[model samples]
Target: MRAYERLLKYVSYETTSDESSETCPSSPKELVLAEALVEELKQIGVADAHVDKDGYVYGSIPATKGAENEKAIGLIAHMDTAPAMSGANIKPRIIKDYDGADIVLNEKLGVVMDTVTFPHLTNYVGQDLIVTDGTTLLGADDKAGVAEIMTAAAQIIEADAQAGEGSAHGKICIAFTPDEEIGRGADRFDVEHFGADYAYTVDGGMLGEIEFENFNAASAKVHIKGENIHPGEAKNKMKNASLLAMEFNSMLPPAEIPAHTEGYEGFFHLCGMSGDEENAHLDYIVRDHSMDKFLERKAMLERITAYLNQKYGEGTVTLNMKDSYYNMREKLESDMYIVDRAVEAMRENDVEPIIQPIRGGTDGARLSFMGLPCPNLSTGGHNFHGKYEYVCIQSMDKMVDIIKTIVRKSN
Candidate 1:
């Protein structure tokens, strides 16, 4: 089956991961897709295909005859959708030969995807686009990745069966992970058991893209406590925590935000905020490509916390900060050939490689640090993690061919 067809089947399972949940998979619903994937892998000739206790799926295809001694290559993709939008009951429709005009996603909800806001729509004018119905995200962030890997695996198996020893290639390993959106996709991963000298995560945006560098990530949570007083009797008595929380946000660089930053630039994003008269909270994520700059960003947050606490009471402001993942370029620098192979594979398929740094982290980032030397490959998707998300059919098919070329033996 085509990769997009498999994606339609995969998105029907409703695999939105929960950030608040402490479970391994983060949500029990992810296991439903995991189990189904295991079954599909086994049907495709991966005899040992199985889902682990933590909802990670693993399968492998043995190298043909003389190619048994060749190094193994792994393909990885996440199974769960992001929590930023709802993934339940996704109704996707295909726009065949897009006209480069505004798309009315939902007439009743008055939701329209305009070309002015998303000018990238012009890029897929002659191709088919699979989009959502304005109520939920399209789940193409990584499901499109999963489908590409599966379709490639199926084609490899079929070719090997027909050509026998003539179709020589290295061992191919496959894994589908859970909770990638919440940053725990590689927490319980068994990298040693995966048995790949190197891997490529088919979990990126746009076609012909190969990403080896990603953000050095950290999350910060700030809490403020204030003494409430009657407004009529208050002179300097009322210290509103809500106002203090706003002050803390104001201390951050106004220009250094997701909206203003691009390429190698760093940013402090305020993901969530809640406040009242006596108590308030701010949640933020800090990201930078440079390790030194990443440390400085964290230190800036610490300094702001200290200043707020000294100005208010000693126990007024409390800060909780933790590092998420570092840039994978540090780990993949020595094994840059893996990245070159992907670039060559894309060119072989007549697609020009776009080697760019990911603005966000992928499971491959953490996996590379864990001794796997993995880079990320595109899934032909655009506008991920929202209702306006889409994937190009021709791009998905091209990615499938590119993956096959990456695994197959050269002439």
Candidate 2:
């Protein structure tokens, strides 16, 4: 089957990961998709395909006879969709030969994707676009990547069979990870076991995009403790935690927010916050392309917490910061050959290579730090984690060819 068909089948599984869950996959439903993918891989000639206890799917295609000694390359994609939207019962609509106009996702709900807000729609004027139904996300973020890799692998297997001598490629490793949206995709990833000299996370946005550098990420959880008292007596005795949380938010530079930042610019994004007069909590994610700036951003949060604690009490405010991932550029700098190969693959496939810094982190960034030197490739997805999410079917087909080209070039 084609990549688009595989994508349509995969998205129906509802593998939306949960951040609150402590399980390795973060959601039990992810295992269902993982098992199916494993079976598919085995049918595609990856005889060793299997899903691990953590819900990570792994498979390997051996090298061609003459290329047995060549270095192994890995392709990775996440199985779980983001927790920000409902991935269940996704009713996707295919717009063939798009007219470069606004798309009506749900006429009854009056939901539409106007060209003014999404100028990128103009780029895919004549292409087939797969979009959501204005109710749930389409889950094309990495599902497109998964289907592309699977189709490419199947093609390679078929081509090798036709040769009748041996395979026509080097060793190829494939992994479908879960809980990538919750920032734990690499937590239990057995990089050493996967045994790849280099890898790529097919988890980027847009076609022709190649990313090796990403944000140095860290998550901060702010806790505010306050004394509750009657409204009439609240002035001196009561310290409203919710108001304190707002004050804490106000202390940060309003200009250095996600909406105000772009490119290599860093930002402090408030992901979730909730509170009451007795206790309150704020969850923030800090990101920067530069390590120095990332540290500065984290330090700024610490300074704000210290100032608040000094005013309220030593233990009134507590700050907890944990590093999620670092820029993969540092790891890939000495291994430019990997990036060069990807660019050449795209060029050979008639796709322009758009090398840029990723504004967010990927599993590749963490894998690179874990000695994989992994970069990121596009899945042709846009407006991820929302109801209006979509992918270009033609772009996905082209990506399959690109992956095959990369594998052939590696050999």
Clashes of each: 0, 0
Superposition TM-score, candidate 1 onto the true structure = 0.90
lDDT for every model? 0.93, 0.92
Model 2 lDDT tens row, 155-234: 99898878754346789999999999998999999998898899999988899999999999899999999999999877
lDDT at 15 for candidate 1?
96
Worst 10 residues of 1 by lDDT: 160-169
lDDT of 1 at 367: 95
lDDT of prediction 2: 0.92
Residue-wise C-alpha lDDT for candidate 1, range 1-411, written one tens digit per residue:
999999999999999999999999999999999999999999999998999999999999998878888779999999999999999999999999998889999999999999999988899998899999999999988999999999999999999889755467899999999999998999999998788989999998889999999999999999999888998887889999999999999999999999999999999999999999899999999999988999999999999999999998798999999998999998988779899889899998999999888888888999998999999999999898999998999999999999999987765
